[model samples]
Target: MPWEAWPEGGFPRFSEGEREARREKLAALMAENRVDRLVVYGTWGSGDAVHWLSGWPVSREAAAVWAPGEAAKLFVQYRNHVPTARRAVAPEVEVAWGGPWTAEAVGGELLRRGGSGQRVGVVGPLPAPAWNHLAAEVREVVDLTAGYTRLRLVKSPEEVAWLRKGAALTDRAVRGLEANLRPGVSEFELVDAIERAYVPYGGMTHIHYLSVTSPSAPDRCVPSQFPSPRRVRPGDVVTCELSAAYWGYPGQVLRTFVVGTELPTEVRELHRVVEDAFHAAIRALRPGLRAEELGHALEVVRRSGFALCDDLVHGFGGGYLPPVLGAEGFWTLAHASLELQPGMALVVQPNVVTPDERFGVQTGELVVLDHGGPEFVHRYPRGLRLVG
Candidate 1:
């Protein structure tokens, strides 16, 4: 599919073939592990597995049981959610209410499906109570979260198509927030602007973190996970890490903005270093590039006498897959030996802060790893934006 050919005004729907492909891959994984039944669990905060497998973005709590040649059964909590959950899943899936206790209901259903002597593979964040119940019923329960993450590492063409729409919506939100940047606007109002830009087009806000501070007497270094009531002031620096989603896929973009035309020398220098480090990672991105090799980009920040207040790189779009790295000596690295592959989405944000950790700037966005190099998902203009 062409990158920009998705429908304009509603949620993008995956084709039946797409759903079948995912099911096939998952079934193969279960067979390789010698599992007779697979239990996929999800909740409001963490539902990537349920969403990917059944097309339903989980609301409160949900679980599914799948075995070879048998139709998958999806159990959802809160009776009111059953209708929408039924509408969202495939026609073959059986959707039902889990009564008072969702975990116990799933456990009872599993036992009826001949789970007593079978090996079961589990995915998603199943609570301890639920895990204990399933373990007692089944012969053995295998944690398949790692294997599930690997399955999502490489997205399908349809997933990429949806990601493109997500990135476009994210760009719209950031630009909307940029246009509202001026003295006297509260951080909450800024978040309102961001949501207004995309919600009308069915976009959802995954995160809209903002950091407001005066460049001359900067107090905050990184974007706050929650927005404050603090109002913007003349000559203040507004740095943000925003993400807007289309369904479950989201695009992340980090940027720094100055509230006035006069850019502080230190802030300018800091952004320059950030841009350099961002592009350095871009130039080094390729299909076979090692995760640790991307650390070369951090060298630019370290050499410039600045350190990072946030992660420099991470796998994104499909549940923060792997290769979460930070500046050397600043944060611990993970998946250091993982290799980059085509179709993987990643964010290369380099939030460069002073050695004192009092001032910083944000820059970077989501990119897809290609054979040639990293393909930027967002079209938001790079560099320090000036407003007011």
Candidate 2:
């Protein structure tokens, strides 16, 4: 089933006080930058900032304009959604039609809010046309992307609660996948089973990737992005890297399993290497740790004669946020070196790639850093599961 078929309430929301706190944070940054007004943008699929400030998501295109001293005015596409948006937002937020042309609509709203003499700040992904239009009407345009990333890196109490819930839903999905694991079942069937697992809890979408290989040809089989007609077989190594979202927040988890009996010796060794990297990086995931230090922990895999496929770790909020740990080449400089702090949520993915690019393993989990140490949000067994 499609995620749209699921109930709208599948995702929980932050309290009104939480939403106000976010606005105040942005407003403070605007003041520090000498920006007289702030314009936050959101699109159909990427509406984190708009949702952060207004407590309503933009299914199409939307913008929220804040003038520092007054309530924020939200402009969304389609007047029909105004009623729904109004119901989602706090009383202090004003919901209105941003018109089909978001750039023009937001531009006009900015002029009315602060006129042409005030400096304006932009955050999130704003269309170039809308950006140009707004630029013509403001005294100066400042990019608040970095400021927004810094602010969002640390989760509030409310955000942590939501993330925890998201993690629970993810755990349920993985269990559902495990329960349905057996020979003769097609990969697509397993995919459906995972998606169905979320509908009951109100999960919006199950973004996932699953692939399978025989023990003898672990390096020979190529994984499919989407499920194929091929059915599961005994001794096949099934690997999945999946995530499910609740109220726009998502938690990712990964697993590799043998369809029956034990894993091949080579596969077991690969998993061992990946697990070492996962543990080494997580041990450094504490309040005072630097982002680069956490990344350097992944160097263990290279020392073990294995390479990483992609990113090692990232800050997770409405979506992937700043201070990405792994980037460029795994051998090169790390992405960014920001300080780790309590209340930070992250996805620890230590994927191992063989030099031949055929055999690999992914062992990852959703984790939150507290003052004490790192806590696992989703804790499924780290080793390879044997499914019959």
Candidate 3:
């Protein structure tokens, strides 16, 4: 197969088990919600619903509808609007290339094929303009809220294996980049070091979020730059929030490194406390755990001493993440009593940041929940590094 050829091994080249898993989950939701037919719709960044049904990933916009007794139909956005939609969607999509349509029309097009008023379930964020369109057409829409989300919470064994590759790459990115970092390097230089180390290892830009911090201010990871402008001095720290990807699957890792020389006394203590909290969170993972139970584990860090800016951990994959993690629409069961199950991918980095105080403290790793406990995707490092 070429670099872009797909459907190899009976699964989409980018996602193994994603299509069948999504279909089964959506069908189950339709049955549970009494939806005779469901319009699992989306556009651009809202591709979650579409990806949740078909193996196709919509870069710009796309839609899919599933009927109880029929195959799902997919629709890609028009050419003038999104070129990538055409490339990303499978060529055999049941429905594609509509002349023009609102978000609701995207749904309506699929509904038309499936039959209207069929007790439809909607799975996308509908804009006001499109809401009117869907409202006038499909009167009944069960939110399908937890129905689909809960289904996505747990990963399959295959997803875990793929995520592990990403995690390994992220670990390499962190370790390799730090070895190249130095006192005179700018943020951009450091970013270059990270990605130069990272890109060859794994990915497309999907999970490339990273941050750099100085040891004097150890808590956070900021975006990268060219020249990085701000030079690292002796005793400075570089904190990284880097993730690697095998296709679009992500494995997040956060690690701190010292530049020039040794870390300060307070920074070392802060790192220790944060690492303690992080491992404690890992220990707390299991099939019957609550999402918010991590807050308690974070407190263990807070007590050991450090002010955490908030949020201990979050869900991962396909834009599904906590609001604290820069996600626009993830249903952060982060604070709820939601049960943690095996096979879920998680990025837990309990960072302690001070809005007014100097120097932050944190470290984190991606882990897959296993039957016995959480299995780390990213290799755990024993200590921070001192580059040059």
Candidate 4:
């Protein structure tokens, strides 16, 4: 069944209180930066960061700046000025519509807007020209990535509630595929099952990423479907990796399945070793543990004898997945020795290879940290499950 077939309330929206809390946090962030004002840019969901900060998402190539003294303002380009300004912001935030700017025009406006000599901060995946133009002014033009991200890492009560609803709906989608997936099913068909099951509750068009693999073609399966006619076989190792967005927030998940009745001894052992390593990483997860130290804990598994596929564990929330968003390569992880704090959420995946098997297993659980160690947000079987 298509996701549109599901009930309307399957994924719930954040309440009004949630929006207010976000604004309060921004007020605090501006105070902490000690800047007279902060500027943000981008559109669509890429603009979501600023949208998140100011309670407005931009529709045009515009800028939203928050001055510590008065209410925030959103300035837009021509054509989209009214609708973008009117539609993009929270009721509490104010919007300003401005026309297109040439390089000369932008500099003049910044100077006129009390931007000169101010130690302003800018955030987002902005064009170099736009960023440089802003940086060109001021005694200091700081990148508020860390300051903003730190504020973001901890979810508010409302965010937790919104994400939990998304996870539960995703879990239901996985369950649908679990029951119907089999040897003759094409990878594309499986992909369809996942998407069909995800919508109707505000899953929207921010597509999910899917990958499937088999032990034989360890290098070539399920990264995504290509309308393949290839049939699942007895020895195939099935897997899929995904992240789906609800509203503007993202929830990531991974699942593994094996074909046939039994596993080869080598595959079985590799699974067990990686599973143990995953548990070790979980045990080490808690508030006050260093991100690198938590990353280094994966080393214990390597020492204990699981060959790591990669050195990666991460901070995940509010974005789509190509792995690690907001940086180069397929993904990026934190380098600081900072302690993991409460309100932080993470996905702990420790999968690696054994001497004989060319492909190993990757299993994961989305976790939310609390006074307890780490609570699994989306639970699937920890050990491998064989699918016919």
Candidate 5:
């Protein structure tokens, strides 16, 4: 009951009904795909599928076995996390030790649940070694990653609640940046302050704070992980693409700030163009909208005489998922653009760089696609801010 003291009644926690609906959906997907048994496998870095189905945060490695008509069973790497896993997962889910022998543990459970000689499916990107182990016992190994991805494309009520909470913290980080940013303040100091602000919200700041500033050429913005001892001065531009994750769900925002009272005409124009493009993309977000149409929105930046720097939009759930927009020039996990659907969360980062790379404006917000248009999740002001 010690874990019960942690209080799971708030936004990030899910109800039993919500969790059951997810399991039922997974079972239906497996049946449709002719998959007799399905294993949702992942590590801490890629555990969204497992967490989505079982509600347990994977530390090192974990899996959830979905056998049709049987209660889903979760497997964790270490026995020590069993108690915590129990508290994290829904009541009906079964938990077992897995770790060094993950395949064996899951294999035994699947076979016991009528999976012997049945078609097996692996969801998400399971490491080949783990698959080899599972494949040794199970005869047919099918790639059901697409089926799982489709299932996760739409957010559940619980997922939306958690994402909104995470977005609130991301907005708080933006405000924290505004209050602490001043002349002579190192990027390191500002980042530290933002991290502290997330603590009250049960959020953790991403390790890399893209805090970069420019003084001479105030129009340019660049992402930097290594915060230097370099300090801000008057007439400087400070850009931060800050982010935070709450209960494993991540929310991120991009903001550009000027250090001086008078904003330069050149930088102001760049900001105006970027904001206009952002609004256009927002208007384009609706159910049934193809991903490529959203990608075409990137042309707005190019038409405004700016080069596209990042994806026009990217998917987000517990973290960045798939079906990225304007991903033609950038790296993406998806082969083609997917249709926009309600409950899908996105970070619309429309970045524009000058022909000379001397000036740019990058600003965005976490949003959820709705029946109408894009709904703002992180509600901080979208335009460039003048802060001293």
Candidate 6:
């Protein structure tokens, strides 16, 4: 199924087999690099690798120490969090408290496991003190952030299932916003509407950005990173970028809405060009397609004499992977040589705007690449919406 609501008991979790597979992959990478030990760190607001390896969403701080053929030792900070970490981590992992300092705890364990002089592979943003501690114990400390990122590029079946659920919740949130949209509604209230739609089902908010401006005298060309107290007016245009998460996975969708029945001529033209660009990029998406080739799809926007204020496309799910491309003439393309592969998730957002950056419209959603083509993750109704 393309869309799935939260399950009866709670959200589904990755199986033990899945966790082992990820560890095996990481171990293989470590072997290739001749590393003796691997340390995966996780702190509040930044713990993708730790969660992937140990299955414990980081609370304050956490670290997992592993060696070939040995069970991972997970160290969590704040003495009180140990109980939850023990419950959440995989059955094979050994959970412990990091004492007063997590880095020293992990470094002490590394020293005990192999003494000094072993090469260690580090993942995530391990703080400087932790890095120095590890360095003092190991012959060399290698940064394996890129290697970890590469491992996350392709999703397993279980990960894809989680992403599908996230997409459904995200769609529901957008519909919630649309239902409550009307003149005099404050931007903060719009956020409340969105949260109300998915929070009941255990969904968490990843992002809910809003941009409310008068269409006739538009001042904003892109969604604000944070919502404002500005109220929706009769002829106001609202552009939004929302991502509702299921677990750590999230599906992103961008859209524009008008508070009145009629769209301003400039807004209509801009949306038409954006829709064209969205479709063009979707049609060009396929397995084995070079990342730079996808940038060509946005030529229609340039031809229509409209510019873009946001990225035209980017890799999503598991830390914004790669191949972040912008409209041809507007921004530079990164990871241009990358290729789209099956099971990779991407967000194709075409935030079309005028040259003067006065008017704009956002349209797009997350999609997963397949053997044949891209599959839309969201079922939200497409095109510009008219509200009130």
TM-score of each: 0.94, 0.90, 0.82, 0.78, 0.88, 0.93
lDDT of 1 by residue, 92-139 (tens): 789999889888888888899985898899999999988998899889
Writing each residue's lDDT as its tens digit, candidate 2 over 210-253 gives: 88777676543223568888788888888887787776677788
Candidate 1 has its poorest 10 consecutive residues by lDDT at: 1-10
Candidate 4: stretches off by over 4 Å: 1-21, 42-48, 55-62, 75-88, 94-112, 115-117, 136-140, 205-207, 220-231, 304-306, 310-312, 319-336, 354-358
At residue 381, candidate 3 shows an lDDT of 73
lDDT on C-alpha atoms for all candidate structures: 0.86, 0.77, 0.62, 0.60, 0.75, 0.87
Using lDDT as the measure, name the better of candidate 4 and candidate 5.
Answer: 5
Query: After best superposition, candidate 2 residue 260: deviation in angstroms?
Result: 1.5
Task: For residues 1-388, write the lDDT of model 4, one tens digit per residue.
Answer: 4345234633233456886676677667777877666776666656457657554435556667666455556666655566655654565566655555533344455567785787776666667786777777656667775566667777776676656655666665666567767778766777677766766455643444344456645654223423355656667776655555455555656666777887767567767766776777788878887665555555555675656553335666654221231112123354454567787777776656544435666666567778777877775455687877
Query: Against the correct fold, how does model 5 do in TM-score?
Result: 0.88
Ranking of predictions according to lDDT:
6, 1, 2, 5, 3, 4
lDDT of 6 by residue, 147-202 (tens): 88888888888998889988989998999999999999999999999999988877
lDDT by residue (tens digit), candidate 5, 116-141: 58889888678787788777777788
Query: Predictions ranked by TM-score, top down?
Result: 1, 6, 2, 5, 3, 4
Give the candidate number with the greatest TM-score.
1
Clash total of candidate 6:
0
Residue-wise C-alpha lDDT for candidate 3, range 25-84, written one tens digit per residue? 777877877877766666655546676556555655666666756776666666563444
**Model 1 superposed RMSD (Cα):** 2.8
State the lDDT at 62 in candidate 2. Answer: 80
lDDT value for candidate 5? 0.75
Least accurate 10 contiguous residues by lDDT in model 2: 327-336
